[model samples]
Target: MRLTSGPAHSLVQLDTIPLGDWRALCDRALEPNGYYLPDWEAAVNASARGRTDTSALCVWNDGPPARLIGLMPVTSLRRAYKVPLPALVSGHPYGTLCTPLVDRDLAEPAVTQLLQAARQAGARALLLRDVALEGAVMQAISSALAREGLKPRVLQSYSRACLDATGDGDDMLRDALGPKKLKELRRQRHRLAEHGPVSFDIARTPRQVALALEAFLELEASGWKGRRGTALIQHEGDAAFIRRAAPALAANSQCEVVTLRSGDTAVASGVVLRHQSRAFFFKLGVDERYAKYSPGVQLTIALTRHLCADPAIASADSTAAPDHPMINPIWRGRLVIGDVLLPLRARDPLVELIHAALAARRGALDVARRGVHILRGLRTR
Candidate 1:
């Protein structure tokens, strides 16, 4: 599909975009994570109960055969910054790393049109949150903004923990954790084995996933999350979303359930979502009773080895917070994540003010948090 000059973009309802076109555009995008997948989006909608603000900003080729080239899912927000200024945000809060599904070959034109269409739809600004600073979407947005002479202000920026599994997982682990640390980890595993026969299991088939997921939910609920009242079972919508989405992903061979067992009981478990050569370490839970043995870390080690040995997987994205206590030390690699406020038009005073306010607030919060961290470190020392 070639862009032939004139107006080639419009805002279409999410349900209106054809399935084939939606999936094709998603795959064509430089980076397509599990969170941005069409099914995942549907799962998010299912969990949304009834929020009518959702829509897709689409870009297409004005040709003899008009074809969809790019898409960005957005929801309208009213009364942002205590004012009646309407703004657009990509995806729901639960869904992180929202990026437009655009063909890289035509990224500049597609993104330009996307911004124009969004602006025309009464969106004062595009408040993209939890965006990957070094991702293809960010790159495209930067290029598009530069081409159109628009300036995008950063609301905040931070690093996210990730794992580069392109090389041997064992080798990567060995390098990251020195020989002494590796020996200590092995010893810890041996200590864990003293309780029972320890093993790691992977569930790929539908039947296995169905059964393991129940155990996963149970295990997750039995840990700190349950005590803190933040477990999936505590949130009905999240549980429902996982139940519907995981099976669908498994049916397509895109989901993997991994569990570390102490004899017949599950001690640690995690969910992995795969798309092409990329794998996302979505979530995990540990058995609190076995906290002394560090079952979660043990399971992560097994997972690293498993992913590294597999020829199909090129990388494993931690999908974890930047300073995650457990995964960061194990993975070491970093993913650049940021929040960028892009003006819908070349000059929008309201948008500019809102962006500046958000940036200032985020900066102050960061400094305050850093001060607290420093005080805590000093106290410990």
Candidate 2:
């Protein structure tokens, strides 16, 4: 499908978005979202299941050389949230943090146009999931909504682990984890070294990243995720996505794979993505055989130091779940993320119905998940 040009906004298929315009938007975006970068998003759309139908809601500057001022990948509400409403929801970008790319200079107008575009698409509301609730982009959206006698309602919110990379890495770690816990980790490291010299390795070049990613996949598949059939490598499409995305992003110095090794044996590995001055720790995989050594935590510790030492990086998003046991204690900074519902028209009755449907769906899913957990626990006992 070709990009459909319009006066202000157009809904183009995700894969059809112009690369040059998308890259320009990312460069001048009010905030950085590595997952939404063209290379990563394109890879996901092409190879990830349920993502092939994704479309990009674009707001343009309509210049002699048209500039993309705002871009968001979205799917219909029924497809994404099973809500029977005339709304669109942000597509999952293979990772959390779906804040849209809106040019900072044209933010207010770009957002106003985006809302209009959604309405033109016959949507009564626009749902943005996993967005930075307090970020500049959200602020612009809120302002735009307010001017039109509307407001964004946060459907759900949580504080996730993040890293403030400005200060000394060692000092930051010490402060976050405390001396006693640090000592215990150090002890674990020493014991891990008994197998061989423990080392942290990072793969930056395309070839290096590709090789490290294979190792990461194998490690992830050898653990609990594999047992549950949820490892990326377990699915052909997901495996293809990371395989394509990692190397492409690495070529631009936008991605890397970090591995923790005991001598020559890989114990833990993770993929990290970069955009602007911010980094995203995408996913981590560990070798269960080395569980006692806490290889995953060890690798994260090294990653922390590595990112902190980088002069260009200002912060890192863990991209982990709320209060993740592995990362929360190590990265003390918190980023408030949430799902926001943007009402497209003032006093629209459909907006309330949409909100209620979403809330009820979420509540039901939570209960089902808890029930599953209880059943598993009982089985173990």
Relative to the true structure, how large is the alpha-carbon lDDT of every model? Answer: 0.77, 0.92
In model 1, where is the ten-residue run with the lowest total lDDT? 76-85
Quote model 1's TM-score: 0.88
lDDT of 2 at 368: 100
Candidate 1 C-alpha lDDT tens digits along 112-204: 888888777777788776777888778888888887777777767778777777888888998888899889888888988988899999999
TM agreement with the true structure for every prediction: 0.88, 0.97
Best by lDDT: 2
Q: Report clashes for each candidate as comma-separated counts.
A: 0, 0
lDDT of 2 at 162: 96
- Candidate 2 Cα errors over 4 Å, as ranges: 1-5
